[model samples]
Target: MKFEKNTALDFVLNDLFEHYRQHVVAVDRITSALLEAGVVASQADIVNDHIAFRTLGVAHMGIASFEKIFLAHGYRKMDHYHFAAKKLNAYWFKPPSPNYPRIFVSELIVSELSDAAKGVIHRYTDAIVADPVDSLNLGDGQQIADFLQRPLWELPTSQDYNKLLEESEYAAWVIFNRYYLNHYTISIHELKEGYNTLEEFNAFVEGLGIKLNTAGGKIKTSGDRLLRQSSTVSAWNNALFADGITLQIAGSYVEFAERSVLPEFRNIPKSQLSPQQRRDGFEADNADKIFESTYTAQIKDKG
Candidate 1:
């Protein structure tokens, strides 16, 4: 499907370009570091050539913009797969180098969208070619570097440089996953009685192909032990959710609950606290303290 180059699309394109530029810079930095460290004794030209060969096959704005539009239409991303190119002897056979990281495209599997929504998507695509950027000439690395330097934010910092390589690699995989896979599942159930084991509730989610542990799951409850114990149990009624979707839901829900629910408790002074309430509150506060200490320790270790 084609989409017109509207202002919104242009904004998306700019962001995609900046993202790609940052990724390229990060890769170059890592390669430079490795070369200096004697890990790779190759000349800068060879390294640059390798990077160009790897990334040249990737479409900058076109494929990226299409993936974004597809996501907006409620299509989930899928898993990414990569294959290595084979090396051949110089005389007999020279296998074609793959020239880039194995490229993956996001698919809009029809099950997630309504007919009306699909119609809207089709109309949107008819206005412009999905591959407009394919026809546009992109400049080489030096040109990209000049453009990137124009924006102060585009310059990499020591912290950013340290993290960018790892983050960009992960981000690429994440984008691929969101475009191609069913990363989340939603299940609706009627409450018959009160409640049973968390495992039973989670089993329903698992049956739908959602995995809580993989995505990081949590149970919401007013009860202290119920909350702590639910988190403790390896197998419980915890509904499983996957990475891209479930983490978003859990993060937003927790943040919302903290903002909305905690304020009411502040109205009651410490003097009015019931014995159990005081104990529970104390334990919760202590848990937070411990967590902070451990987190600080880990950060120090990393440094």
Candidate 2:
């Protein structure tokens, strides 16, 4: 997401990203490494493939409600994706301009969870009788930015959090960290020669001592083999629960994606190729694994 911070949308997006970068240690570590390695002079030099968020599929919330923020900013809703095993639904939004990163928003199918998990979720979200975004003045970027960070529900107790974690990690995540940026993808193909492929980039990142998510593998490739991606394992941070108890819970992570140019566009010169020439939308299989970047299993496995 390259921005000069000149428009309301720019300011709002930058504000949200700044907040995310501060908490997600991997974001800066990767950015600083890129700077020192001369890959980019600053963060803006990296092309953000997209930014993602997690939500709960409950009343007055979820994709229908959360998407209004970006929709109001002139984004157009695109393809829909479903992760059956994960019991999740998502949609990717195309940015109004090429300069902004695409938006990917996903929501957990709360009804599909066990009754105990549903009860724990409702206990926290039943209060949201109306869509929160509806009350906001969407034109006010700062207002929108603040709303994204605001607490929509009370914090969950460790007992409730763990219960949800057992059934659905996505539920556990949203219960505590509502509307926070899940992960921001760095466009790997947009980087210089040596770092443009996931194979080389993964080695670069791993050399920095960063752990990569090995849910499916270090690199999750689409069936067409055009879209390959890898993400860092989430770092645990102290999270305060409702009962004044804190636990080391998984937080946000950073993602790297390599979207190869389409076959139809193979003849185009490298300098003339545009984003549209590359593999566009996301794959359900690839995303299903990427979602596990924060799972305990991924974080615990040393091998």
Tens-place lDDT per residue, model 1, 166-241, is 3232222222222211111111111112212344434433343332331122333333432221111111111223
Candidate 1's displacement at residue 146, Å, is: 16
> After superposing candidate 2, which stretches have Cα over 4 Å from the reference?
none
- For candidate 1, give the lDDT: 0.25
lDDT of 2 by residue, 1-303 (tens): 556777778978898899999999989899999999999988989999999999999999999999999999899999999999999999999999887899999999999988999999999999999999999998888899899999999978999999999999889988999999999999999999999999999999998889999988999999999999999989998999988899999999999999999999999998999998999989888999999999999988784
TM-score of each prediction? 0.22, 0.98
Please state the error at residue 30 of candidate 2 in Å.
0.7
What's the true lDDT of residue 154 in model 1?
A: 20
Clashing residue pair totals per candidate (backbone < 3 A): 11, 1
Model 2 accuracy (lDDT, Cα) = 0.92
Q: How many clashes does the backbone of model 1 have?
A: 11
Q: Which residue pairs in model 2 clash with each other?
A: 1-48
Error of 2 at 41 (Å): 1.1
